[model samples]
Structures are given as structure tokens and as C-alpha cells.
Target: MSSLNFNLQEMMTVAASRMLAADDVCFVGIGLPSAAANLARLTHAENIKLIYESGTLDTKPKTLPLSIGDGELSDTALSVISVPEMFRYWLQGGKIRTGFLGAAQVDRFANINTTVIGPYDAPKVRLPGAGGAPLIASHCQRVLITLRHSKRAFVEQLDFITSVGFYEGGNSREELGLRGQGPVMVITDLGILEPDPISRELVLTHLHPGVSVEQVITATGWPLKIDADLKTTPAPTAEELYLLRELNARTQEAYAPDGLST
Candidate 1:
């Protein structure tokens, strides 16, 4: 295996998965977050419990579940509950350690837009509306956002705010009566962004291996902030890549035999 697997999607997933730890009890959503969380479980953080909104608790799906309701998830779960109980007891009860979710569009404050692409009244691309994202963002202990980084996806402002991140910053979530710590980190294809402690703004604190700072700036729609002491992300290790590919193979064979790769 090549030490330099410049596959951006694979790199991004690997980077995101590293954020998990053995003790974490994560609330995972579909797509990138799902793959990343599953990768974490398969490799290093085997003890990281995964909870899906479909009421699956501690799901150990062999492949990436098609949806929260995917039987493979429930089949491997430690226990299953109804949607209401899942929300009331785990998420709203603040038992979830991290809410790992994806976003269509994101801003400097980390606010997400998964509603529409154009004006609200009459829009262009109509995206998947907020499912449990709003509440999950509100009550989880902390949130980790995953999205592809492009000028279009990383917008100056959202067309419709699907999930609030920092809002207007400075204790805004508290003011709005929303619990949780809001967004702590945003993992993207280009790099990793984390909130600045003082400003609560997402700053470009790290760059993916072989990616330039200028490239990240160019991809961002807004004027991105740079950390004075930025870090360069380590290239994916052979073990990490191997495990990720194995996981991708499993999900593909189970969900998309036609030829889909995570």
C-alpha cells in the first residue's frame, strides 16, 4: 500500500475517526460520520459506543448501516428503544458524549444549513431537512461536524439555518436556552477547524498532509481565520488506510454492490 494515498475522502474520514476515543459514547448519523465512527470502533477505539437516532444503542454494525433504521444496526445493537425514548433518555437527558453529524453548508461560527440551496420561498437544490440534527446539536455534550470543504459548502452565510452552531457567538446557545457545548471541531477534506476560545469562530488550525494553507483559504467562502500556531495533520498510516478500506469494502458489499466506495 502506498504511504501517500492522496484520496481526499479517505483522508478526511481517517482524520475524523481519530477524534474518537475509547471512552466516548457517540451519537452518529449517516454518511461520513457513520463511516468514521465505524472505523473508530473497528480499529483503535473499540470501546467507543455508537448510538443511532433510530433507537439503536451501542450499534456494532458489520457494515455501515444504510440508515438509522437499518436492521443490521439494530441486530448488532446492545439494546433498542423507541425514537422517543432514545431522544428523551439519551440525547435530551445529556448522556451522549458527542454528536457526530454532517452538514450541507457551514459558516465560521459552525452553523449548518441542510435545508435549501437558494432562497427559502423558492429554492434551487432542496436538501434533506433537519431530522434530529437540531435537537442533537442542542443537547449533546459536544458536537463534531463533518463535511466536504468547498467554497460552496463552506458559505459566508447559510440559506437556511438547519442547526445552530455558535449562533452569533459568545454564549448564544445558552442565551437561546439550548444545552450542550455547540460545535467544538469541524473535520473537512481540506483540514480541521476548531473554535477559537475567545471568539468562538472556526479557525483553520490544521491542514491535511500535502495540502497547502492557501488551498484551504481558497476553498472557504468566507475569509477564514488562521491559527498562529497551525498544525499539519499526519499522513494516514498503513494500518489506518488498511482498516478504512476493509470497512469500506464491507459497507459496499452490503449496501451498494453496483460499485460504491466509502
Candidate 2:
């Protein structure tokens, strides 16, 4: 075993970023999804249009946003519209090419949970309720998810389904009349999982550098399946690592106790 230059989180973010194309009109959620989308914009997908639920369109933030309502998003956006217009016109109208999302918990079917940790009425830990996630999952041409791999986060059942993935799996999403293709790629610290075309069950398709199939399976709460043509995800390149580090450093500085960086 040898050491790698980048950490697993960096590899995960870079892997998720690579899924974007230069011309994509992406709806970005906060946390890992925001970081990954911005990384794509700063690197290969320079022309990618980033739409935040805060009503900022084509926002090019200098640092990672604290939330969708972060001032920098509006400050850097090409245009700022009303929330209704943002959703009704841009999202539901089918102008969004991809939706990058994050989740507190996810199941084998790609269903997401961010509402509560336990039973809804009396929960162990209450999480931020779903904002625009459900609509994004329903209307965007496609959806991409990023979250750390862990038994707790990758669960057998969600405490609550904040957003529909494949729903019950198979043609369930289509049967329910969801316009977008449900979560296509789920990028995690350990590897990348993609929904099977036929069954709609998440299958481990690519293992990150230094990660093993056993490790990924052990981290997942469900009986995770393996892709017949499994592959290894290429480690983050020097440029990608440098850019990611710089972005993170800037974010830390911007959100420092004193004030945002100029």
C-alpha cells in the first residue's frame, strides 16, 4: 500500500465534477454538491450555468457558499430572479440539464433523506428539511448525488424520502410521471455507484484509488451490488487538486471570523 497525494473527499469531489459538461445548465445544492459544481465550472466545465435555489442564475462564486442564500451567489450571478420564476421557469420548464444534490441518507434505490434521522414525529436528529430538492429531482434532465460513504449515510431505508430517486425502483419513477431521469451517478468517498438501467438499483461501478470492493460494501447499509464491468476511478490530477485546495482555502478565508475576503 502506498500513500496518495489527495484525500478521499477530494477524489470524490473531482469525480463528481467530471460528470458535468461545458454547456450544462446545472442546479446546485449546497455542501459537497456546490463544491463539486463550482470545481467543474472552474476547471473543465467553464461554461456551465449554475442555478442556485436562492434564485441566482449562472452564479460564479469566488468561494464555497455557506448556504443557498449566501450573498456571494446573488453578487456573482448573471441574473437574479424570484424563487417562483427560478423554479417554474428554469427548473420545471426543463431548462436544467443536471441537478447536483447532497443527502443525509440514501437507500439502494437512490431515494434520499434529509428530513429526520429517525421517526418523523419523534426524531433522534432533525435535519434541514427538503428545500428545492424534490422538484430538482423531478424536473431536471438528470440528477447527480455526492455524499460520503458510510453505513449511516448509505442506509437500507430512509427515515423520510425528501426526494424521489427510482422510488420503488425499475420503472417506478416513470410510472409516477417524473420527467427527469432519477439519480444516475452517486459519487462517494469510497467509489461511484450508478443506477442499473433495468433494475434501477444502485451498483458499485468504480472504486476510488486505494479503496476495495469489500470496503465499499462494508460501508453501505444494504446488500450493495457490484457492476459487472467495475472500474477504478482515476485519482485527482495535479491541476484538479490544486484548484480544489485553492477553492477551499478561499472559502475558509471568506467565512473567517473577521470578514469575507476581497
lDDT of each residue in 107-133, candidate 1, tens digit only: 889999999999988899999799999
Which candidate leads in TM-score? 2
TM-score of each: 0.95, 0.97
Per-model clash counts, in order, read 0, 0
* Candidate 1 Cα errors over 4 Å, as ranges: 1-3, 256-262
* Candidate 2 Cα lDDT to native: 0.94
The lDDT for every candidate, in the order shown, is 0.90, 0.94
- Candidate 2 local lDDT, 1-262, one digit each (tens): 2578888989999999999988999999999999999999999999999999999999999999998889999999999999999889998899899999999999999999989998899999999899999999999989999999999999998889999999999998999999978899999999999999999999999999999999999999999999889999998999999999999999999877875559
